[model samples]
Each structure stands twice: as structure tokens, then as C-alpha cells.
Target: MKGRLVALVGPEQVELHEYDLPEIPPGAALLKVRRANVCGSDLHIWHFLSVAFRDIVMGHEFVAEVAELGEGLTTDSAGQPLKVGDRVAAVYYHTCLKCAACGRGDFSMCSNAVASMGAPPTSPPHFTGAFATHYFLSPGQFFYKVPDEVSDAAVAGANCGLAQMMFSLDKVGVRRGTNVVIQGAGGLGLYAAAVANRSGANVIVVEREPVRIAAARLFGAHHIVDMSELTTVEERTQRILDLTKGIGADAIIEVTGRSEAFAEAIEYARVGASIASVGNLNVGEKFELKFAPAWITRKQLRIVGVLRYDPWYLRDAIQFLADNGDRFPFDALTDRVFTMDEVIEALELSESRIVSRAAIIPV
Candidate 1:
């Protein structure tokens, strides 16, 4: 069999390439691509912002169907029965379960995990990216069968953004009646709102963009603050504080890519609170503001940095969508869709933030 892959070859350069798909080897599998999502990180890669990923395959977040399972592979990571034709989503990376990090079930922090996407084509099973007709999972890459109750649009982002949000919220231990402040209303922010809301937290989303503000509300944000209308950072923070009755946010999830957001995040959080920063991923981008080092120590705040997520979160993410798919506007998240041939244009649209979400159907 043969497969097609989209490769990020240079700055803002993408090309479709072909590869041969040998018979599924032991413990390996083949996924018939369904839908791959364009995430904020893809925008950076699309614009040629980093050199390490210049020659890597383009996408990492998607959902697929089990086209074929190889020798010794009949069950998913959770030991559930699995077979061809099953709809599924998987962790973006493969963990060497024997590593110290994996030994503790912290796959996201595993030093030995191989990222399925972003790997060079020189590696066998070159269909490492999801933006292709088929995706080949090398040995150790795990996947979970998605429940039929989940819609494709709702499950499309489960592997990346949704799963990461699950892990981020868990790290903060958001509980019932917890006042949560979301720093952005983009994909991750919206996901955070839904997740926190499901966990019985009151969510307040601060966003300047009108589209995302609307999206935040749809995603279950209890309070929406339009920063444009607020006028300044202090005013926006004060508005959030007011919503919490001046107690400030018990927890703040930073999903805004703006470097300055974290500086402001410190101001929004209450004493002895937590701040989980999953956004602000730009490399070498300088923050225009400054903070007092003593403030962090005085507050005794818990600060954590999230990378990807545990594979378990993928299953949890899919399940969350299945349960709440109708309650929130999951369908509206996918504002645009493109064919495999429109890869470049799709990236451009996503980069421009013209839509809340964009997808590539590679079937």
C-alpha cells in the first residue's frame, strides 16, 4: 500500500509526499485518517518559526479509524478489545513504559517517548503525521477506541487540546465551587471552561476577541470579559476580581499565547492559589511587563508548566465530549473545513485566526 504525507520542509513551506506502506509489522498499526486539527502550535510551525521542526511532518492532533492492526496488537492501551474499523484517537507520543517518568505513569514527562508526529521521514513508517490519507503508528504508540456517542467534530481535538486541558485542570485540583479564571477564549481556553464547568467550577473567561468571547460563553464560561471593552489590563483583572467578590481567582489557566498574559495572570490569582500555563509557547518572545519576584513567594502560589498530556487524558477527553457534546457547542468549534489539497490555505486561515477551529479531512 502507499500513503501520502504533508511535510513542513522550510519556513512557511509545505509539500505533499508519497511513501510505501509495508505490511503492518509486529505491534504496529495503520490508521485511516479521518480528521486532523490545526492547532496554535501548527501556526508557528507553518510560519517557519522554529528550525528543529523545519523538516518534520506537519500535524499531531487528529482522530482516525483503525484500518489495520498488526501482529500481537488486538487491544488498546487500557486493555480494551480493539479491531479494524474502530474510530479512535491516540496520544501524540509513544512512551517507553520502562522509563522513570513512565514508571510513575507520567508519560508526558517521559524522556524516552518518541513523538509520532514531527519525526523525520527517514524513520520507517513515514506516515508519522495525521494530515495524510493514512497514519502509521510505530511500535509503542497507543490509541483508544472512541465511543460512538462522541461526534467527530467534538472528538477531533481530544488528543491534543482537550486532553492537555484535562491534565492541566487536574494538576490544579479544581474542585466544586472553585472560581476559575481562563486567560484566553481560544481553543484551549474554551476547552478549559467546559472541563472546569464539568468539575463544578465557576469559569470566568477573559478575552478581547468577539468571536472567542462568544465561544467562551457557548463553552460554559459563567462570566465573559471583553478586554477591548475593559480598556486596560488592570481593568480586566479588576473585573475578574469583582466577579469573584474581590477574592480573586482560586485558579488561573493561561491559554493566551501572549507573553504578557502570565505577568497579568499573577495579578488575577488570589493568595495561595495556582497558575497553570499551557499557552505562551512562543520561543524567545520577550514579555513587555515585569513582576516582583517576592509576590510569587509571598503568595506561595503553585505554578506548573504543561507540555502534552497523559494518554489516559485522551480517553477521558473523548468521554467528556461524548457526555457533554450536545450541552456545549462542539459543532461550532469547527468553523471551517478543508480538503487534503488545500493544506497551505488551511494553515493560513488558522494562522489568521479567521475561525475558532479548522480541520483537514484526509480520507
Candidate 2:
């Protein structure tokens, strides 16, 4: 079969290349792309803000239908029955399950995280990335059948943002009656708010961008703190504290990808509260900020760093969206849609933060 993929030739440069697929090998499958999302994390690679992989697909967080299934595969990563023609959201980490990290159920930390997608173009499975007409699901990569009731847009993020956010939010304990302070209103932040709200927490989101601030409310943010009006770290922190009745938030999550948001998160968290850092995917971007270590010691706060997530959370993410799909406007997030041919324009708009989220439908 012949398919097309968007290749990252260099920093901020991409080319649409066509290639022929090889015969399906055992323990592998091919997915005809349905819709792939331009996640905030993609912007890092799009603008060369992070480590850019050459001759690879540029998009992640997608939902697709099973075009062909290989032998020896009976169920998804979540232990549910799988078969061709099923729409599914797969895990991004393609790990070797026997690794020490996988032995302890830490698949995200596995030694071989890029077993498949990192392969060269001449390899049998040439389609490594989701920004293509097809995606090759190699052996051991976890995938879950998306709920039949869920829409494509709602489950698109189930692969990354929603899955990872569900994992982090669960670890941080944003339970009923807890106050959650979300820093940033991008997909990660918005997804965090949705999960926290679903779990009965009062969600307060802080974002300066007007477009995102408006989008936050749709994602179940009970309160929105506009950073533009606050104008200073002290003002923004005070607004958060005031909303929390002076004791500070029960949990504060940083998803702004800003280094200074870390110190602000510390100030907004109450004693013994938990804080989750899910943004900051771009490693090279740095800023100098000062905060007393004594504050952490004095507050006795629990600070956690989140990068990737457990594979099963992808299943949980799909089920969560399926169960509560109507509570929040899932469709609104992907209203600004583009086709694969418009890849460059899509990346530009996503980086500019013109829209909260955008979907690229593969032609």
C-alpha cells in the first residue's frame, strides 16, 4: 500500500513524502489514520524548542481505525478484546515489556521507549508517526479500543494529554471537595480541569491568554483567573489564594510550560497539598527564578514531576470521556480543524496559541 506522511526535514521545516508499505509482520498492525491532534507538545518540535527527531512524523495524540491486524494479537493494552475495524486510542510509549522498568509496571520509563517510531524510513514499517495516512503499531506497543459511543475529537487526546493528565491527577489526589489550581489553559491544563471536575473537585484555572481563558470554562473550570488583569506574580498568586479562602489550593498543577510557574505553584499550594508539573516538555528553554527551599520544607508540600503515563490510563481516559462526554464540551476543543495538507499552517496556529486545540484530519 502507498501512503503519505509529513516528515520533519529540519527545524521548522516539513515535507510530505509518499512511500510504499511492506507486508504486515507478526505482532504488528496498521491503522488508517482518522484524526491526529497538534498537541501543545508538538509545538516544541515544530519550532525546534525541544529535541527534534529527523525523518519522523511530527504529530501525536491520535485516534484511528484498525486497517489491518497481524497475528498473535487478541486484546488491547487494557486487556480488552481487540479486532480489525475497531476505533482505538493507543499508548505513545512503544516499550519492550521485559525491561526492568516494565517489570515494575513503569512502561513510560522503559529503556526502549522509541522501539518502533524511531526506526529509519527504509525499515519495513516506514510509517512511524501519526502525521501520516497510516500508523504502524509494532509489537508490544499498547493500544485500547475506543468506546463506540465516544466521538473522534473527545478520544483524540485520550492517547496523550487526557491519559497522562488522568495519571498525574490521580497520583496527586484531587478528590471530592478539593480545590485544584491549574496553571495554563492549554490541552493539558484543560484536560486536568476536566478530570478534577469529574472527580468532584472545584477547578480554578489561571491563564493570561483570552482565547484559552474562554476555553477553560468549557472544560469545567469553575473559576478562571485572568493573568492579564493580575499583571504580577504576586497579584496572580493572591487571586489564587483568595479563591482558596487564604489557605491556598489543595492541589496546584503547572501546565503553562513556563519556568516561573513553578515558583508560583509553590506559593499557591497549601501545607500538605500536592502539586503536579505536567508542562515544561521543552528542555532547552530556561529562565532564572528564585524561590526559597525553606518554603517547601515549611509548607510540607508534595511536589511531583510528570512526563509520560502508564499505558492503562489510556484506557481509563477513553472510558472517562465516554462516561462523561456531555458534561464538558469535548467537540469544541477540535472545532478548528485542518487537513494533513495544511500541516504547516496548523503548526503555526497551534504555536501562536490562536486556538485552544486543533485537529489534523488525514486525507
Candidate 3:
């Protein structure tokens, strides 16, 4: 079989190239890639904004159909339990089932974990990636069955954004009446806002982009703070404080990965408040930790950094979206779609802020 895949040849370089499919190994399954989403991390990797690597297949968030099963794999063509016709979303990570983290259900923290497609040959023979026309899958990792009520686009975004939101909320202890602030209203921010609202928090969204702020309101943000006029961190902090009646927000989820946003988060959080940092703050980037002592002594602020989520968390996120589909219009978050041949264009548009969430249909 021959399929097209987006390859990161070098910094700021990406191209769709054709490759011949390899043989499937025992305990492995082959999937026909249906749709792949351009993630924020994909943009970071493309710009060399991330750690370097040689030529690499650059997609992780994707959905597909079962095509074939290997010798030891018991599934039928279209992969037994999941018929050839079943539509599914692939989890992006693989972990050692016997590890301590895996035992604790923290798959993301497993020492032997690797990117779904980037795993070396020493790991799993068929566990390659979903960016191509057909890719391999390994055992022990979960593959979710996408419900009929969920659209392909919604599942693509939910694979990451929705799971991240649920993980952040769970980490920060958001409650029914808790006041929450989400920084930035991009793809992740919009999903976080909807998740926070559904969790019964009084959600406030802070975004510099007016267009995004307007969209945030439509996505269930109780208040939208236009950060355009707020010049200083102090000003932004004060604005957030004012919105929460000077008690400050009970929780703050930082999604922009901007240094200034972290500074403002530290400033706006009430003593003992929890801050979940989901954004990728550049390494070696210096920001004032002026409130460190106060945060520890007086406020007892709990600062937690988040990474990609566990499979169960992703499952819960899917259920959340499925249940609250009416309240949160997951469809509205998607700005456009392109074919697999237009993978480069999809990445470009996402980087330029021309679209919120973009999907690439590989089939």
C-alpha cells in the first residue's frame, strides 16, 4: 500500500510525501487514516519552536478505520471488536503496562512511553503513526469508538483539547460555584471555556484577539476580557480581580504559554487558589517570580503543569462532549478543513491565526 504523510524535513519545513506501507507485525493492527488534526504542538514543532529531531512524521491527533490485523491479532479485517466499518479515534501515546505510572493509571507519566508514531523499531513493530494513508497500531493502548452523535471534526479536536480541559479541571479542583479564568481563546482556550462552563464554574476568558473573544462568549464564557487595552501585568491582574469581586479567581488555566500570561496568573490568583499551566512555556524563558514567597506563605497557591492526557481522561472528555454537545457547539470551533494533499496549507493557516481548529482528511 502507498500513502501520503506530512514529514518535517527540517525547521519550518513540512511536506506531504508518499511512502510504501510496511508489513504489519504480530499483535498489531493497521488503520486507514480518516482525519488528522493540526495541533498547537504541531505548529511548535514545525517552527523549530520545539526540541529538534531529524526527518519525522508530525501528526498525533487523528481518527481512522481498522483495515487489517496482524497474525497474533485476533480482530477480523476492519479489526474484529471494531469492525472494518467502525470509526475510531487513536490515542497518541503508548506506555509500558507494567510500570508504576501505568499501574496508577498515569499512562502519560510512564518511563517507557513514546509518541504513537515516533516510537523506534525497538518498541513496537507496527505502532507507527496515523498521519499516513495506513498506519500500524500496537496492543495495550486504547482505541476509542466514536459515537454517531460526534462528528469527525469534533472527535479530532476532542482527542486533545477536550482531554486537556478535563485534566486541567481535575487538577485544579474546579467546583460548581468555583470562579475560573482561561487565558487565550484559541482552540484549546475555547474548549477549556466550554469545559469550565459545563463544570459549573463561572468562567472568564482573557484573550488579546477581539475576534477570538467574540467567539469565546459564544462558547459559554461568562465574561470576556479584551487584553488589548491592558498594558501591564498588574492591570490585567486587577481586571481579573475586579471580575471576581476582589477575591480573585478560584482557579486559573493558562493556555497561551506566554510569559506575561503566567505573570498575570500568579498575580490574579487568590491565596490558596490552584493554577493549571497547560501552555508550553519556552525553555530558559525568564519571568519574574516576584510573588513566590507570598504565593507559598500567604496564598498557598498550587501550581501544576500539565502535559498530554491519559487514555481514560480522553474517554471521559469524549463522554463530556457527547453529553453537553448542545450547550457547547464543538462544530463552531472548527474554522476549516483541507484534504491530505493540503497538509502544508493547513499548518500555515493555523500558524498565521487564520483559522481556529483545522482538520486534514487523509483518505
Candidate closest to the true structure, highest TM-score? 1
Worst 10 residues of 1 by lDDT: 113-122
> Candidate 1, residue 221: CA error in Å?
0.6
Clashes of each: 0, 0, 4
In order, the Cα lDDT scores of the candidates are 0.85, 0.83, 0.75
Which residue ranges in model 1 land beyond 4 Å of their true spot? none
**Residue 281 C-alpha lDDT in model 2:** 67
Model 2 per-residue lDDT at 117: 58
Q: How many backbone clashes does candidate 3 have?
A: 4
Which portions of model 2 show Cα errors greater than 4 Å? none
TM-score of model 1 (CA atoms):
0.96
Q: Which ten residues in a row have the lowest lDDT in candidate 3?
A: 118-127
lDDT of 1 by residue, 200-227 (tens): 9989999988878888888989998888
Residue 194, candidate 2: alpha-carbon lDDT: 90
lDDT by residue for model 2 (1-363), tens: 699888877788988888997567777888888999998777777665554355567777899988888887778777778778899888876778888998998877887786665665556677888888998888778898988789998888888988889988887898999999999988888889899988999899999888888888888899998988988888887888888888889898888888889888898888998999888766776767678889899999899988888888888898898888888887677858898899998888877767557899999
Kindly provide the TM-score of model 2 when superposed on the true structure, using C-alpha atoms.
0.95
